[model samples]
Target: MTTYSEEMEKLGQVTIFDLLPPSPSNAFSIGDSVRVVITVESDSESYHYLEAYHPIVLKKRGEIIEIQGNQQYLVNFAGELHVMKEHEISF
Candidate 1:
C-alpha cells in the first residue's frame, strides 16, 4: 500500500500557505463561530468533475480553527474538519 507521505508527494504541494502571508482582510479569526453557506453538486454525465464543500456541511455550524491565507479557512464542524473559502462561510 502507498504511504500517506508518498501519496502527498505524488500530488506535489497542494498549498503554499507558508509562502504567503495571512490575508489582511480576513473577516474571521480563530475560534470564531461560523456556518457554511455553499452547497456542492456534481454531474458525472456532463463529464465535469466539480468539487467543493460537501452537502452535509451546508448551513452547518462550525468554528474557525486556522486561517489558510487567501481567504481560505480551516473550520471544525462538530468533530469533523473541513477547509472553506471566506465566501463559503458566514458568521
Candidate 2:
C-alpha cells in the first residue's frame, strides 16, 4: 500500500517535513483568527480595496500560484472570503 507521504512525494508535492516553518512557526492555522496588515489591491478592472486591517479567520491554505514563490492563504472576514499572501496578514 502506498503511504500518504509516498503518494505526495510521487505527485511532486512537498511533504510537511520538507518545509521550513516561517519565522513565527506557530503563526496561524486553519480556523485561527488573523488580521489583514495591508489592503489587497484587486487584480481585476475594478479599483476597490479588498480588505484593510480587519480581523479575519484563516480558512485554508492554497496552492502556490506563481513563480515569485509566495503561498496564498484563504481567509474569511465579514462572511466574505479572500485570498492573501502570508506576509500580508498578522495572527
Index of the highest-TM-score prediction? 1
In terms of lDDT, the best-performing candidate is: 1
Model 2, residue 47: distance off in Å is 10
Residue 43 lDDT (model 1): 28
User: What value does the lDDT take at residue 66 in candidate 2?
Assistant: 24
Off by over 4 Å in 2: 1-26, 39-48, 51-70
- lDDT value, candidate 2, whole model: 0.52
Over 2-91, each residue of candidate 2 has an lDDT whose tens digit, in order, gives 999788799999767579765443345667666655533423221123322323332332332222233466666656666767766676
For candidate 1, lDDT tens digit of each residue in 36-61?
65543422422122124344465368
Q: Using Cα atoms with residue i matched to residue i, what is each candidate's TM-score against the true structure?
A: 0.55, 0.40
Runs off by more than 4 Å, candidate 1: 1-23, 39-56
Poorest lDDT segment (10 consecutive residues) of candidate 1: 42-51
Per-prediction RMSD in angstroms?
Answer: 9.9, 9.8
Per model, how many backbone clashes are there? 0, 0
Error of 1 at 25 (Å): 2.1
